[model samples]
Target: MNAGYVRLSRDDDKRNYTSIENQKLIITQFAAENNLIIDRWYEDDGISGYKFDRPGFHQLMADLDKDIDQVLVKDFSRLGRHNARVLLLLDEFQERGKRLIVIDDHYDSMQTEDDTIGIKTWYNEKYVKDTSQKIKRAIGARQKAGTLMIRPPFGYTRSHKDKSEIEIVPEEANYIKTIYSLYLQGSGYRMIAGYLTGNQIPTPSMARHAQDFAKGVISKHKIAIQWSDSMVRDILGNDFYTGTLRLQKRARSTVHGKDKRVPKSKQYVFENHHPAIVDKASFDLVQELKKKRIKSNYRSSHAQPAQPELSSPFGSCLFCKDCGSRLTPIRRPASGRERKYYICTTYNTKGRLHCSKAHLIEEETLMNDLIAYMKLCRNSLCKDITAYNLECTGDEKKTSVRKQTELQSRIDVLKKQMQILFTQKIRDLANAHGCEKVINESYDAMQKEILTQICESEKQLKTLRNSILTDTDKKERSQSALQITDRIIEMKTLDRRDIEILVKKITVDKDGLPEIELRYGLSHLIPCSPSCHLNRQENEIIYQCMNLILQSDRDYTSARYLSRALTDIHYPKSAKGVLPYIGLMLKAGILSQGSSPQKPYIINKNRFEIKKVMDTFIKNCCLV
Candidate 1:
């Protein structure tokens, strides 16, 4: 049996002679002239010759060892532009007792010895490489001029007046806005996707198909109304909806004919290139929220909430104090009832040898503890609003006006240098007799250095500007903290948003005690007034002893254990030396004496007076 192969690429489509139909016609005429019958045809349309993974070519190879004894093509280039692969194919045919024929190159394996096949293949590959370079240069030129034509994003359509411009499709734009709104309102990607699909809204591809159908263009493809999380995420991440044109994100690889992603720094961006569907501020905020969600491991971005009411407010904020791993929530059947508990993820996955214990605590217990802590903080803030204001005011530093002016001047100078370099490049290009390449290369290197310096200067300037907060900023922050704490105290139950706004982390110890770290340094505010007359050194010793006892796995710790722990941490206290502090704590009702003398120290942290003394000592030591 004989096999005929034909291929046409986008570059070849411009030439009438290289068209698929024309190539097939040429092969048929040659076969007829030679009295050879062609039994099967393999066609690869609009695929690059540099690629070897064409479906039609794959099918042809599968039959080559079975029914086909000969292969025919219009030319060797039709087989492939990859020189090594084309030459190997020719050799394989010769060794397999099969005949091969090329009509345009006038080559026949059975009748002629063509030693120039390698040279011909090499020339074909070189032609492809040169054509690829020319296309890239043309595209780059257009991109630099901001006139490169690209497909409009999901919420837009090509303008009739200007092919390079895009106009927002109102219906699709509304859907885009809805997606952003839902995401900002604490909806994950999958939830948003389900909502859209449930509402019978068309997907991006389906919308395009409907538009074509309205114009009387018939298609046999089925348009499904299903939306996927990935589709929704893509829409949310696309900056084009913010009136920005971000192009050159992907470039074709010349060797493999595959698209490779270009780095963001290398991609071209033109702001305000079109009307926006979503405002820039909202879009930027969504991006920041997405990043925070990912870093926190809050939930699977693609997962829909199983039960909204059952969702834990501590989502990803809960952790094990010992292992520093997230506490995964689980529902278990206990005493014929369902109980929700959070356990150390490390202990559950890696076993007890890796983590000391499960660090398990009931969800209700965590909620109550967190609320109580917030209330304590609120009370402390209320007791001395002036003191709270003073503490928070020191948190922000006033930027040096002289340094900011220096950064601004440096940035301006660098930008001016870049402009001068660009002008010099243009002047050299226009006046150069034969040194244009050298001139442009030198100018580009200099421009890149200047741009990097400008970027650093601008970042420093932004930091300085942000650090120079006014008195009003401090007052607003203090007020915000008070309001959030008040809400926490009044709410019946906490939700995910509330947790995200108020808490940074909640680390649980082996004894199921939670230590909450409030967001925005709210935890730094002392929760009780320090009326104790202890000196700084004495206060530090007390604080360390209390922390050691509370963090211990055992209920009771002796003075020897506390001394060793403190010494290992550079406190350098002997067992005899720590006994004095322990006695003082016991006298102050912070530590209780154990029943046995072997382990006589007990830290009853649940006692109200103990908590008060500890808080006072913590304030004196500045350990808050």
Candidate 2:
């Protein structure tokens, strides 16, 4: 029995001589010429010959166990590309007393000792290797030419006319802009994802599938639009929207290994390769905000303790100036009033040895100071916003104005339709109970979608207007921001969300007075009051203890230790007598008690400085 085997590789060759039909014809002609009868034919199409995992090859091997006398092929290349696999198959056929013939190569495996056939097989393998190398070279050339190698990002698609370039999809681009606005406005990743999903916005995969189907790249299939937190995160993280394409991002390490992402340094990027959906400024801002979110991710996992103040309005935005770590909120009610104070995380958790100070600040005092500061700078902040707007105004004012009008018009129309739908639902309220679930879901989705559209249009308008703000426009924006701040300050109950939307961070100074930095306004440094006053003898003794405390180099010295050190330094004062000095200093405000387990008295640096300067002044006066 004789069988014919043929293969056609996608990239290797699809030309006339290498086509499946051509190979079949060549094999038939050779079989007829050689007077060999062919029984069955097997073929693998559009598959690589470098591997024997092809379907046709497997069928041929299954039939090899049969009483097959001969296997006919167009050439040694069609049998399989790998030299070793081809040689092994030839030897196996020889063992089975079956002749494997390559008609085009004029080779026969029956003569296993023939070295010429071996050379022909080697050349056939080289043809495949050469073809593969050429394909890789072609790709490298395209990459060098700044070709768009990836599927277009979420806000874009490949141009209908030019497959190599991306064209912005207006509707989809709006969704992308809304995502940025939502994040910048203080929405979390999961929040953004839920918002998109709730709005019934088509997921990236679903949108891509539809686009591909329309382009005839894919056949008709049910597209399940599912939005996930990961998908939302990817869109937020992608730099492609900034008009850059980074290609060859990931590759498998080896045949059996997992896919490994290539670092940015190793990636080939085409910057400004396409029209940006999100501007570089906005993109950069979002990236920085995302980085802060990542650093504070651990803070979110912390469950609120039993006290109300554990849930501070500052959240992770409160930082200890001394340790550069987040300040931990401690609930310590003084007298009967509930109070919360923020302290250095290092000092609170790892002890004062790790951090010299807690940078403690009363939450109410911090907020009051912040409010006072905002009121002080409100007018200047308004002017600054106006100046920013004016300087950042885009030159394409006419074009942007037209686009804004168009978008606003669409938004108005959608709103009207939604209002009509809502009215209809209200009118049909009696009959709506049975389908309430469906109706509510549809209504909510529609409402969110419309709101998303309005937000997107406004964002685009802002972008177009503020791309390059003029001096006059800056004044207008500053005035607008000032008005918003006025409203925020007037609110009776301010929460973390409210604060997060306006302030970038709250930096606590070493003295526990917070420096509240508005996102776009000036940073306000709250003045700290002196905690204590000292008398003559108290100043002299506390000054000595302060020196000892400074020289100790420990985080802080206990009042008991300071007393013993004072006794040694004062000569006349015994350790027993020094306890009264300690009591006097603690009462007179020279020392501050910490929340340490033993409630040890720590040196009050502010008061110590006050006494140090006085001591110097008195000594200089005496000398004079």
lDDT of each: 0.75, 0.67
User: Candidate 1, residues 1-624: lDDT per residue as tens digits?
Assistant: 988999988755355447788888888888899898888899999888988999999998888789998889998889999899998888788888788889889888887667787899999899888878877876775564345476577889887895655789999999998888777656778888888988889998898887778879886667667999899999999998987777788987665557999999999765555677887657876786698779866553344442355555576678899988888888778668787889999899999999989998778657766665666667776755456556655653332566677678878887888888888789889999999889988888677667655764565566556643346434556564467567668984677656765677788887566777776676777544121211333466677777776666776778888889988986766575577778876887667888889868776665455466678877756765
lDDT of 1 at 264: 93
TM-score of each prediction: 0.56, 0.52
Model 1 lDDT, full chain set:
0.75
lDDT of 2 by residue, 280-343 (tens): 6577777876788688652432232222233567766778777788887777666586767778
- Alpha carbon lDDT at 292, candidate 1: 73
Instruction: Point to the candidate with the largest lDDT.
Output: 1
Q: After superposition, how far is residue 521 of candidate 2 from its true place, in Å?
A: 16
